[model samples]
Target: MQGDTKLKVGILTFHRTTNYGAVLQTYALQKTILDLGYDVKVIDYNNEEIYSYCDYRVLYGKLPLKTRVGKIIRYSHNKKIAKTFNKFRNKWIDLSVECNTNAQLQSVEDGYDAIICGSDQVWNPLAIHFDFDAFLLSGVKGKRISYAASAGNITLWEKYLKKYWICLHRFDSISVRESEMIQPVENLSEKKVRLVLDPTLLLNKKEWEKLEEPLGNEIEKDNYILVYYLGKNRALTDTVKKLQKQTGLPVVLLGRQIEGIKSISVPAGPSQFLSLFHHAKFVITSSFHGTVFSILYHKPFLVFGNGNYNSRMNTLLSALKLQSRMIDNESANLERINKVVDWGQVDSLHKALKEKSINFLIEALR
Candidate 1:
């Protein structure tokens, strides 16, 4: 796709996920690669050997065990959400359906000009339990590129250090979404890692404007607050309720499972998501993608990170100087939450980030 070569590009991501940030980032990366004219495909990690142990018990149920000699059929492992995710994700790209063994992935190297392992925490070793093999980053034989991939926290892990070093050493180019992670990545392999924006930021407000068939400005005419949660923390939930009681505006929630006093329970797609930001009086969310769309639409929002989990939100928010907008759900002030953010300035920053990111992608892919 770059030249006369039809880029049989395969991307590795945590795609069988319901996470909004994960899904949107995948969509952004695929669209970016497609816009570059590459023939792309997305592959998911799967292993079906588990739950068979429990199934063999006579009390609950029994599975057909052809252990004498047979193929390890993995398709039966992923069902419901996994199947649904693949159903929708496969629509975007020609899905990879042939690989069942490590040998298959190795053979796959012959099909593509390059493979990108990116846009999410793909390199995180913790993924092996959920997928067949997560070190797919190390499996590619052609040109390898990793973009905006975070190894969760950049701290030392003796087990992963060697593989991390090897993968980074072998890549043609590497970039991270978080600035704080640049040092750790370099320390691991001495690779000069570029600080690139997330793939979601590659497109501007105008580009997003085209994808979303605009919702009529009917509901947006009234004032309401938007809330999204990523925290398992209870304090964050209490704050959302308190804010709504005091402000007396209806709260429309997204990306959370908690019951709301005055809220609508619906998955927010691009248009509804955009509308939430386009018209919200204010926002309070603990999710990273919630903050992303808020900033994209120039809406003032409060962000809370998971303290137990090492979240990359702090580094990103600091870079944008939106640290003031981030509310520590543990200790929050209702008075300050009411303060409005300057939509004009946020719009300018998003514009600059989008422009810089688009230019970088065009240059890097070349």
Candidate 2:
């Protein structure tokens, strides 16, 4: 490690204040930079004014919901179990307060060493509902590096092509999380985009502790299946009910509170979040992070799709060769409680990807 450089890095995560994934990803990013021997600080991203505290902003902007009603309406239509759009909307409002509340967002721009834009779904136009390429179009004063950034898919937006193309020229270095994202980011930005692991994947199990909850009531470390469901289809619920009836092993479903399921509903926070990943018998998930933790823990899992869900989870699953475990929402058959026996193939692929990704991030930070 270089002792003299004393690098200062700022990570921007569109933290919805009450999100588990956002918090963990931020933790992983900070830990990695700290491991690389730099001064690392997580910007209080849910607020804009907090950006003034850091030298560079690694932003994760959330979707816009202008008013309380707009937020309620936007999240109301979606079928989430534990998370609410209103909660997410409130975070963005705080960010807006931090940014525009003072009415001079640009005034807080002068901070420090480098600004890292992602390792997230930042490129997803729908999720964030903002000009992702805006920083490029408007420009930033400090040296810029896009670290493992991606929206979710491999598709490119035509509206931001010119700016996207130009911004690559400005970046000190650029990296994309998914392998498939490379060609698209390259075709659009015209720069070589390196593939890196999701920031959550950057660290291993030992590091997940700081983000975990108090061990006071940690349900005894037993064999319980970790079911990660985002789809609210009756078929999915029916499967969980039947599985519990048959296996008689309690199934812990991770999400905000939705409806129609009797399985344990874990809130979206640190303690249960880490515990779910740490102690699952096997993981069944539609969430990308769920699959990520399952892989890190060496647990076999079935990855399912959200009803008409988009590309984020699929990209990572495909890259990791766990495609068979993924059940498409349209094609999934909930009646079958099947177990995968010869997942040596999945294990091998995960090992190789893990090494390459570990090498990629380690090399890049230098």
Candidate 3:
């Protein structure tokens, strides 16, 4: 508590996840709250599912290619990614003692003056299964505020409507990441919901630059297109090939070793991830944070959407007036990929959105 000994906040987020976006957003949110003079700790909720997302051993069993050699290669790369992300989590994130079960979370809930869950797909049912109830903080004796929490896809199924309605009403303040999510949440919960920016946007480029400076010019010396695809989108690979053919620039796939595509063998930490975005000649991604860092670095980028994951990307692109940058299976041609973006206008809109998101946090915290 920097100011008047305010609330000790515990942020329950995707901080433990191996995804670059998840870790970065968790850091941003924690930093923002700390800057506001509140004590904060990223609650380290232990769940095997969180670690399994990037684990090659788990994915290896699912992969169609069952050769021992192929399994070993995938396993090693996945371990590298997991190790790198774990290192980042340890260095940048201040975490509480691990809590794996509902009983553990319940026992520790009262330790916080307030609990914040946010800035990621924590509410996305597809990714989180067991801890959904824990995130609700049912037994916690503190203010429950959700900041920029996403519902993943906008189409909320009726099956979970009652559960969400109950959880949404329990929060002291609720803010969703997407505009479309606000309406559905408001409708289901029968409560006012604020639309907020992703937590990563809270910190400026200069703040992120400090982290990148240490990583040096490893990625900067050469011109390359950065491809960060999180989903199994077959068309995205074809699109990347098309981009390579059109531009003649080498494509660097981060944390993913796609067939026939050049990729960084080791998983990159947060700083290294930012450096890749900073030095990229162009960026193409399916992940929301990939588009975010591209915009932060002022790099020319294209966003592609797949399956239920399209809503968040669509909402973000539409808001920033960069809808033209979103391409799909049919429209992902050379000309469409080459479409220019007006960064000046996008920056202006981003500034306003950032302010709104901050205001919501301030009001909720107060």
Candidate 4:
């Protein structure tokens, strides 16, 4: 099946968030479907509950005095980051008319041939502030499918098995991001759940490099270590410091300001995030997408397991036969840092998975 202007597809995922992975995955999924020659647009479904977390002002009245003060100080910094994210959304992601309520979302379902809700933790209630109806496509009359849809940890889904069973039955096809989710999702829905790569991995290195922007005059000329961690782990911090001292290279921190780490803070959006990982001498992170980008760029990197949320990262690395790249304990062996990754073997495995994932999408759309 070639590109069909009449075959309208709408993507439902966490596209409005300030996080790099959320926005970039949305872009990758939308771009991939659009490239297949179908009319595609992200179902710009904005939940106020989800929006409040992104906008600091929403919690101003509810927080304690001291916490509120801290929020005030970070407000401007977060605003700048949010602005960059908004710019990227407008420029790259083709979005449908804004839909805030479930009724609003249901109202637009008839417009799409198939609604794809996926490539992110959309099924995770906490991630979406318990907005199940929208993400589950409750009242959708058209075909429904999920591509790499993750629920973070599979244990979270056990409590909501009944809900999963009902909602999942509405899906024409189902696929999950983490391998652990396959059994649970399949058991709940009684549908054969396919384990697929994250949307970021769906696009190869050259495809992603096209979206990468330069780091500008800010440490672009310097060979630096790129550090991107979502959590505040002392072990990761210590490892970064040790690596910096051992390698004699400057460190560039990607997200918020971390205490005790003397690193350059670059207010980077999705594109700059790509460039950082692309040009880094080595990458150190605790984020799943951070690890994905590191692998995509073929960068030498180490990913710290993020407590219970380590399953996703574990699945990916294990699949690629790069288990040594993940550090699960506080004491990391820096010897693995010098260990080279066999890209030829890794790429061969990755290509097979990528082709299988793309085939799933193609067949589902047909």
Candidate 5:
């Protein structure tokens, strides 16, 4: 417990999420804030919709009747995987008292000195949980700030512009993760929005390394290409095959199980996810976090873009000067994938971004 003198901070983000990026980013932001001498807690605001996304039972019920059997089979196979993810959350995250509704969030408002809203796509309308004003610290008193909050897309829908514009005004300061989103947010809120690094990047590579406890000997010793495709890009399947042929290595697909590939049916928790990235000879992925860890670990990786959904990845690669690492459907070719990334230069850029982002957090909190 913190003494009375230390400021009590409540953070609002996707803390209960099972996703590797969401969990680690939440941890990074909390750790960073604690390092700054404040007592921090991730506001335990559990959105039923977001939580349902991870629950196979809820998911199976939503699927078509014809697909129910397959869904059940998949869910049964992933029970342990889900348990691993839940254990990570229960073990590592420091959560505040549970707040289910806006009223509940406001009820606990008096306990905090200030409230922080992000380090993720907490402003994204597509994220049903954040679409409402709760993550904006609505009804809360005192300082309200967003730290590296992401809109997650290049543009916001016209319908939400006015609503977001009004809600964003509550923030004393605004910092967005995507560089392309700064002006759009500024135009909406008429507030100066700063571009900052993702929370995971704010904490250096070594800091993340400490979180990775070995997942037994299940991890293969042989060098292999790690495939983590979160999008429905069939072309990526071919690309993975080509990479396997060229590299003369086996392919290990993380996340969902693929028929032809050596897919790990288990859902990889945060630590296991890190282990996969750390041990991989190379990575080919469509997920934002997949690309992030590849860079964090200084691994040579290729990103498969998902059209407009690829905007966040584009912004990250552009900012770090690693655009060549990305390959889209239009530009898909062996030549691009075979190209090399200069990790030495990338590391320098990451350091600069890390410092700038951390400085923004410190200043915003002060």
Candidate 6:
């Protein structure tokens, strides 16, 4: 605590999203700051623009009856998934009063000693639609800092370069999740940008295990290859099948079910997500967070790159000297899957980076 009263810190990020990585990173960052003895609150400002694409109410507008019917069915299924995500947020995240507009967020600006925006793709213009005000902490009176903030795998358009330059300059200190992001961000703001670990990496495997919920009895009984993919890649199914055949293990697919694959679909929230990763025999994934958890748990895993987003995963694997773990469509061979990882070396590298990341946070907060 700073002085007699605890220092209040407010975090601004994509906390309300249904994505597992988005929500888990938010929780990790909040928990880390809270552990440091500062009062931390996630500013629960809803971005209507981001929600507009997913809102079921949009179906109510004029459209073909058949199209509307299909959307409504999908919306009903999505509502259940959203409910589990909401339950996690309500139980774990300490959120500020709901702020639906800029004015509402501004009202609470003076309540914090510092406002942090980070550990996710908060700076990606495409994700946030170039909304510079909120995530950049525009009207806040507190000290502004960014921790492990990601711009994702995007090239800045000529028109938006000036916007990025102006808003990024608002931060008192800047740190990013990927090293490739550091030079570009520094060039834009003309300020030193530190390379930092994602907040999820700040917590070790044991700390993450405390949040895991048990799997169903049947799932717990089997030794399976856990496949967690974000994109619809036909190759992913074939790769998982190959891994299954190679390891003689059944497949447990997370998220949407594949049409031809014989796999079990697990409806998981953040907590259950951790449990699934922790128990997997061999992990196969195309997500950054999935790769993250696999490394954290020291699981034998293979990662498939997701287009431009591959840089984030590559940077991480390279740092730990585990680049051999990433496989492509052509390189997805049995030998690659069977390759042994130097867990001892990887953990040592991760520990050094985690300490550096924590030190960045400590100095930024000071």
* TM accuracy, model 1: 0.78
Candidate 6 on 93-138: residue-level lDDT in tens? 9999888888888888678899999879888877877777877778
Candidate with better lDDT, 1 vs 3: 3
Best by lDDT: 4
Candidate 1 C-alpha lDDT tens digits along 122-149 = 6655544434233445677777777787
Model 2 CA deviation exceeding 4 Å by range: 1-4, 47-109, 131-138, 153-156, 214-220, 256-260, 307-310, 330-355, 358-366
Candidate 1: minimum summed lDDT over ten consecutive residues — where?
68-77
Model 3 residue 304 CA deviation in Å: 1.1
Per-residue CA lDDT of model 3 for 128-162, tens digit only, reads 77356876666677889999988676554456777
Q: Please state the error at residue 172 of candidate 4 in Å.
A: 0.7
Q: Quote model 3's TM-score.
A: 0.90
Model 4 C-alpha lDDT per residue in residues 1-366, reported as the tens digit of each score: 446545889999999988999999999998888888888999999887886645545465787788777777677677888888998999989999999889989988778889999878989978878788888989788889999999886677666778878999879999999888898888778888998889888888999888888896868543999999987787788889889889889889887667776789888888888889989999999999999999998889999889888888998998899999988767577888779899999999999998899888998888
Clash numbers, per candidate: 2, 18, 0, 1, 0, 0
Give the range of the ten consecutive residues with the poorest summed lDDT in model 2: 50-59
How much lDDT does each candidate structure score?
0.64, 0.58, 0.79, 0.87, 0.78, 0.84
- The reply for model 4, stretches above 4 Å from the true place, is 1-5, 54-69
Q: Each model's TM-score, in the order given?
A: 0.78, 0.74, 0.90, 0.95, 0.91, 0.93
Candidate order (TM-score): 4, 6, 5, 3, 1, 2
Candidate 2's displacement at residue 284, Å, is 2.4
* Candidate 6 lDDT (Cα, 0 to 1): 0.84
Q: Would you list the clashing residue pairs of candidate 4? A: 3-37
Residue pairs in clash, model 1: 1-5, 1-7
**What tens-digit string does per-residue lDDT give for candidate 2 at 53-133?**
221211223544355445454344322422443343343222222443222323333354666666676665645455444
